[model samples]
Target: MDKDQQNRITYTVYCINAFAERYRLTAKQAFAYLDRFGGMAFLEDCYEAEHQLSIIDAVNDLTQVCRNQGGKL
Candidate 1:
């Protein structure tokens, strides 16, 4: 993969781990949550918003989106 793709993958993994830890989810469950909510795009947006948004806030946003889509994390 190219560097950008690698970076995205790395960030996705980080987000997956974060979701898992913060929500007491398994890795598989975390991946499902991310995938269902918008996958890498969601993660990238969250990272980009880090300066203006806390990770907890980002996660809360994602959780709400997941719920709106009929999924829970």
Candidate 2:
């Protein structure tokens, strides 16, 4: 992959790990959550908004939406 793509991949992985650790979830589960919500686009948004948005905040938002939609974590 190109440098930019590689960077994004690395960033996403970091975010996934952060999410898993913070939520006591497995990496797979964290990835599933992101996929269920909005996939890489969601991660990208989080990365872009890092200055204004915390990862936990983003995950919380996703969790709330999932719960509202009758989806279990």
RMSD of every candidate to native, in Å, equals: 3.0, 3.1
- Candidate 1 segments whose C-alpha is farther than 4 A from its true place: 37-41, 44-54
> lDDT of each model, Cα atoms only?
0.68, 0.69
Reference-based TM-score of each model: 0.65, 0.62
lDDT of 1 by residue, 1-73 (tens): 8987787667667667777888899989888777776754556766556425655666676677677766755
- Looking at candidate 1, what is the lDDT of residue 54? 59
In model 2, the clashing pairs are none
Error of 1 at 69 (Å): 0.7
